[model samples]
Target: MDVKLTEEEKIKVLNSDDIYGIMQKILLRESKIDQNREHFWVIGLENNHRILFIELISLGTVNKTLAEPMEVFSFALQKRAVKIILCHNHPSGELRPSEGDKDITDKLIQVGIIVNTEVLDHLIISTKSYLSFADTGLLSELKKSTKYIPQYVLEERLKKQATEIANKKKTVEIAKEFKRNGVDNETIALSTGLSIEEVEKLRVRKR
Candidate 1:
C-alpha cells in the first residue's frame, strides 16, 4: 500500500487493493474534515484502466452519506471516463456495507449501463480496513437487480436517444434535397458517403 502520487502521474489500477492504497493517503492528509464524517468519492478511469480523475461527490454525518447517481456520473461524463470506481468511508470502522450501500450501488450500476460507462466496483473504507464489492463477488449480484434506475439517468438517456433520431432525420432530409437538385445517385452517394442503392432508395421514397 504505497501512498505517494505525483500530480502528473496516472496510476493504472489493477484491482481493488490499488484503490484502497490510494484512498489511504487521501484520508491521512485530509485532516480538515472530520475523520468521523462519511465521504463519497468517485474514481474516473480511462478505457485502459488508467486513472483520469478522483472526485468527492458528497459528504455526510457519522454513519450515512447521500450519493446520487447523477452527481456521480456527471463527473465521469465530464472527464470522458469510460469506467468508474465508487468509494466511500464509514466512520464507524465497520467494513460491512449497509442496505443503503447496496441500493445505491445497484442503481448506479444500472445508470452506468445507460450512459455507456461501466461501474467496476464499490468500496466501503474504514481507518484500518476496507471492503470491496468486486472482490467479494457482490458487484456481480448487484448487477442482476435492475429493478430501479434513477429518474435523472433515465431522462438523460432518453434525451440522447431523441437527439440521435433527430440527427438521422436531418441527414435524410439533406439527402432528399440533393436528389431534388438533380444530383445523380452516384454523385450524391459520393457527397453523402451513401451507397448507390441507399441513394436510389432515398430518391424513390421521397417521390
Candidate 2:
C-alpha cells in the first residue's frame, strides 16, 4: 500500500480483507488523536470489490452516531459504486455492537438490496480492537433472520406462516364444535392437534 494509495493501484487489486487491513491502520492512527467522538464511514467499492472511495457519513457524540441508509447509498450512487462496507467507531472503546448498530446494518442492507448496491460488511471499531459482522457470522445470522431477510424471501415466509396460522384457527374452531357436542377433552386434543389444556380452556370459554 502506498503512502497515498493511487486510484489505479487501488483498482488493480483489493478485497474486503485487504480493505479491512487498510482500515485497521487508518483507524488506529486516527483513534490515537480523538478517541472520544464516534465517526461513521462508508467505503464504496467497485463491482470487483476494489476501492473506489471512502466517505465519512457522520460524526456523533461519545457513544452513538446518526447514519441514514439514504445518505450512505446516495454517496455510493454518486460515485457509481456497486458495493459498500460500513464502518463506525464506538468512541467508548467498545468493539461489541449495540442493538442500534445491528438495526442500522439491517436497514442499510435492505436499502442496498433495493438500490442494487450490495452491503459487504459492517465493522465496529475501537482503538484496541474491532469486530467484523462479516467475519464473526453476525451478518449471516441477520440474513437468516425472518425479521431482516430480503423482501422476496420474507414475503414468501409470511405467506407460509399465514397459512399455518389459518390452519390452526380452523382446528381450534373444530375443537370448539366438538366440545359443544359431547367429545371429551382427550379426544378433542387428539382430533385438533391441540393440547388437553387448550381444549379445557376452549370449553371454559364456552361456559
lDDT of each: 0.85, 0.78
lDDT per residue for candidate 2 within 147-202, as digits (tens), equals 55677877887999999999999999999998888789999999889998888888
Candidate 1 residue pairs in backbone clash = none
Which candidate number has the best TM-score?
1
After best superposition, candidate 2 residue 70: deviation in angstroms? 0.8
Instruction: Say which candidate scores most in lDDT.
Output: 1
Candidate 2 regions with alpha-carbon error over 4 angstroms: 1-17, 28-33, 148-153, 156-207
lDDT of 2: 0.78
Give the range of the ten consecutive residues with the poorest summed lDDT in model 1. 1-10
Task: Report the Cα lDDT for residue 36, model 1.
Answer: 83
Residue-wise lDDT of candidate 1 within 1-207, one digit each (tens)? 122456644689999888888886677666746688998999999999998888888878888889988899998998899999999998888898888899999989988998999999999998778999999999999987746866785688789999988887786787789888777888887877667888788844334
